[model samples]
Target: MATLEGPDVQASDGESDDGEDIPPLGENDNIDAIVESIWVQMAFDIMYVSPNPKDHRKPAYVLLDQEARTSTTPATFQRSDLTGIFRSVLYRELTSSQWETVVFDSFFPLPNSAALKRQGFRAASYYKKWHHLMARLRRRDIVVVRNELRRQFRTLLWVPHPDTDRMWRTRSSMRGFTRLPASSTGPCPLIAINRQALQGTRITLNPPIDDVEQGEMDEEDF
Candidate 1:
């Protein structure tokens, strides 16, 4: 169905016709669904810009899992179809102005190559994708009639890569790769010295041996 670009009364935060704070929406109310779904949809929109949106599908699943894990309290609405839920809600409630804000604000810029492989997204790619989606939405929302224009055209960077597994995997590798000196935080000074010697070809002869003694050393000397 072609949705109109007019302002939705339900979406406005306001005093009602009686000039009182709008009654808190009930769990059964569809408005709550719309609000929650808009956020998820925004997240999905950002994800779509990556080199491989489906390639990193686990992030969304992880996001959903985290939501499920942390949601101890009763939620106003169930997130059954995460992407669909977001689309339905955002399409139904958000004004053109709101949509512009959401599209621009919700995304974090893609990271560098090392980070990109880990994240499956690049900043330039994300910006381009988001720009395309915005154009499509603008046409659908009747941008001309709404007198809406997208300004502050740019993407942003987000710290802490989106993939939890990738992040922890990197951290684990760091732990394995790094060696601490006696004055450092970790308790592996000798190991660090050995690794340093191996890395930079730092060699030492025990007992201040001369070249002759070193050359004559047995296989066990190594």
Candidate 2:
């Protein structure tokens, strides 16, 4: 997901061809699951590059969940296994082009001593991550991609961090960890670990692309 930008819209705008029997998926609640998130990242960014060769020109976006990167979606897919959980969600239909990903470890090996104790993750924290997301939705990279060899919009997937407990959860924002303030168009649609939304065949996530730049960033949470 390069500097994703241009026409970020509600999921309804993008069509879906997902299967009927894919297993359910959720957050990193099962932190000790045999499969590591890093491995899932590797699988999608590499192993699951492309298959049907759909419209490479189709714009796409990914929420890049901090905790549930691989819980349900099968990051790896074969030429014909379009029903894979991860593939189904991201590529709901044959979508997206090249892929690149970051690697992580169960031990959270980064020197950020807190990394080791990383069980699940808080919503938004880093300034760059927050800024980058809003910028993309607000058409940040539209001009550059237009000048280059791509379309004006990028197809994006709304992946949310799960709320392992309802006691601390509600229909939340779709902007990942960032609790972005209301834009000129008001707040983003309530998405996130809402089982009602996540388990549905389609979800509506609207990116109004408004005054996110002027909003405050709560960089300390989770």
Candidate with top lDDT is 1
| RMSD after Cα superposition, model 1 | 21.2
lDDT of 1 by residue, 1-222 (tens): 123322332223333222334433333444323333433343443333222124453222122233433342212122122231111110112233433343322232211112333233333343333332232232333232123222211111111123321211112123323321111221111111112112333222122123235446744587
Weakest 10 consecutive residues of candidate 2 by summed lDDT: 99-108
Per-residue lDDT for 84-132 in model 2, tens only?
A: 1221121122123211111111111222223312222322122112122
lDDT of 2: 0.25
How high a TM-score does candidate 2 get? 0.18
List the RMSD of every prediction in angstroms.
Answer: 21.2, 22.7
Question: How much is the lDDT of residue 168 in candidate 2?
Answer: 18
